[model samples]
Target: MTQTRRAIVLLSGGLDSATCLAIARNMGFESYALSVAYGQRHAAELTASKRVAEALGAREHRLAMVNLGQFGGSALTDPTIAIPEDGGDGGIPVTYVPARNTVMLSIALGWAEVLGAQDIFVGVNAVDYSGYPDCRPEYIQAFEAMANLATKAGVEGARMTIHAPLIKLSKAEIIALGTRLGVDYGMTVTCYQADDQGRACGRCEACRLRRAGFQAAGLDDPTPYQIPER
Candidate 1:
């Protein structure tokens, strides 16, 4: 039997990453899901990650801990920094964990090399997003180029591709596509400050975009927000 090509999907247990995993699987890849515990503000994020990974039928799932919190540059990594609720002043928000995507993708790249895979899937969007610099297309392209150059596989002329399938899509479009791909949004967490139970605050930028996406898609949101918003 011909072996299925394996892929490493960075699953944060949020809607986008989970959807990315579904997309990878739909593309005929035997996906190995990876979730990073990077000292996030919400503990439920990884819990939701494990749940979504299993629910999505990943060939294997692994959790890698990096503790970027040690660096303490962002709200998610530093408890001393408060999570912004005002959406921001049209600037890159504090929610932008410093070098988070870069770090996570690096970890995925290492695993992908070990697994003899050439693809890594990350759920980053430019449209309807928190305006993170790392989520831009140029950044992804640069990372892909760097991956090919730095890897032994690339030296052997094998190319490594970083897949950001949701980069150009609006949140509503992502929701629609993910729904069609059978992603259960309820199993994911997207809040910047989700409680231990994985319920949203309904005030953060992430929560705002997620809620609006469901509304724009005309789909009933399965997310459980805090008391007043619930």
Candidate 2:
């Protein structure tokens, strides 16, 4: 019998992560979808995560509730800090949670070790991102190296691999690819401050990028938005 190759996919219930999950499944992996509840302002995130996991036919779905809101460093984790609507000026945006990817990938690594899986997938993009320092290709490489050295499984020759399939992809390219793979963007939420109904605020940076991507892809924008008429 052929052994099932398992992969831990870090699913944020957003556009990129959902597409990343689909890509892992397409690569013949038994995907274990992992979502982190790091005290994000968007309450709809976890709900969307559940939707994506079920819709994409993940082998298993798990939620890790680690409240990073206690830190109060980012807008996503702290309600006091306002989510910017300028669509990102230059530097890293306020939505860039401190050490978020590190913590998320660390959780993924621990679960992978327990599940006897060596593959982990993250959907970080460089091109059309919010300028999060952790989303860069260099950061992904460094994290993979750390994963190989930090775990007991790695010492036993089970070298871990961190897969960032959407790292270099533009938002339009990603949307196009995910569309071809049957991803329902309407089911996913990327807004920094989505309402309980999972409707996106069309003015935030995330919404701007996502809306632009759909336009560039020449695809129908199926995402539900709560935009005030100007």
CA RMSD of all predictions: 1.4, 1.1
TM-score of 2: 0.98
CA displacement after TM-score superposition, residue 88 of candidate 2 (Å): 3.3
What tens-digit string does per-residue lDDT give for candidate 2 at 1-230?
A: 99989999999999999999999989999999999999888979899999999999899999998989998899999889999998467988888899899999999999999999999999999999988899999999999998988899999999999999998899999999999999999999999889998999898989999999999999999989886779
Whole-model lDDT per candidate: 0.93, 0.94
Clashes of each: 0, 0
TM for candidate 1 is 0.97
What CA RMSD would candidate 2 show?
Answer: 1.1
Which stretches in model 2 have alpha-carbon errors above 4 Å?
227-230
Which residue pairs show backbone clashes in model 2?
Answer: none
- In candidate 1, position 113 carries an lDDT of 95
